[model samples]
Target: MMIQRYNVDQQGVGQFDGGKITEQKPIGFPGEGSEVKRVGPLFYWAWAKAEHEGYIPLHPHQGFEIITYVISGKAEHGDSLGTRSIVGPGGLQVMQTGSGVSHEEGFVGSDMQGFQIWFEPHLREALRRKPTYQQFEHEEFHQIDFHDGVHVKEILGDDSPVALETDVHMWDIHINHPFIYHQQIGKGRSVSILVLEGRGRINETSYEAKEFFVIEANELEEMNIQAEAETRLIVIEVPTTVNYPLYRK
Candidate 1:
């Protein structure tokens, strides 16, 4: 299968708090200038960075499995569930907005960074269920550390406490030296790659920081990623086809 890459300029730029906070949206909505609106069950992806401590006011969401992954500093979450908590770097907060839910976010510490992603499931069934929320500390997630300076933290999958109706798997990977991370993505499924830092080569092609790519496979095969610089990236794998009726914008 072939791979496609979108540079930073190809994505959407969002500024809040009078530019105190900025975000790059790889899959933003219309008028956001992001050519890619979505991939399979993956609905949205936003890489947010805080220049100074700030917050986003309460907002509504419905029928989407949303997740926020903290990359640096600290993040605070509050929602209609009466949940209010703070999460440091490497932590994550997930919300399954079955019917509807409202939430607010605040980021503290200098240069705080994180990602907010939304995944779609069978809306009909999800809407019938109640909204749910959960937060995972940095230690609760499963991590694989290699002596070669390669590391992987599974954000989703069997070992993860996060359970979503969306058939997607995600991970945060890092490497400092020449290394290869491998995976076998089943046929008809695609991998969404976000290069958050440094540079690397995937399928023999070079890519630098702030690059977003999608790989579609014709069959199950090893997906090899080789990086030489100190790098950090995110990967989300989802089926190419939707099994249940999906909600359209």
Candidate 2:
């Protein structure tokens, strides 16, 4: 078993609207100074926060699966595909830019926070399809609670409402007490974990708020996440290797 950790400062930074919005990127683009540029198919992951509000004008994207997960407040998404929607807390907005698409987004409410993640698919196959957009409301996802003060909300998986061509699974987890959470990791796979709130330890390694860790496929069968306090987190599980050629930056 092997593990690597990155603190908030170790990640890249970006801002918009005169710094009204700031971002901590764990898997950013080249020259972005992020520790992990691309974890298999996972390309970019940005944890963005809005002090009062912020906006990003229409931008073009191609052959990338972009997702925005709302954490605290709401986000307004407007795209050229005639898709206009507002996703609130626990909601998700996915944009599969096949051939191409132009879209703009903004954060609303005080202290609005969310994550913008990009996943790359097989470029040739993705570009052969049409551009699309999908939005899942806060009530659209399913949640499961265990006996242990732990809860797992399915964001993307076999049973999740959101579907994509990318082979990935995502979840939002929470635990309110000292507990050990275990799971069987797939062979030749990896999991990207981001500590959104509170503190915890993976095995014996301590991790706090806004930390990012990548657990790779290195003979680790089970992962034990031990929480010492009320902790909340997000996890993205993907293959350890991509079958297609990735973008070079």
How much is 201 displaced in model 2, in angstroms? 1.1
* RMSD after Cα superposition, model 1: 1.1
lDDT per residue for candidate 1 within 17-89, as digits (tens), equals 7777788999898889797888999999999999678888999988899999999988899999899988899
Off by over 4 Å in 2: none
Candidate 2: pairs in clash? none
Question: How does each model score on TM-score?
Answer: 0.97, 0.97
lDDT over C-alpha atoms for residue 212 of model 2: 95
Writing each residue's lDDT as its tens digit, candidate 2 over 46-143 gives 99999788999999999989999999889999999988899899999999999999999999868999999999899899998899999898788889
- Top candidate (TM-score): 2
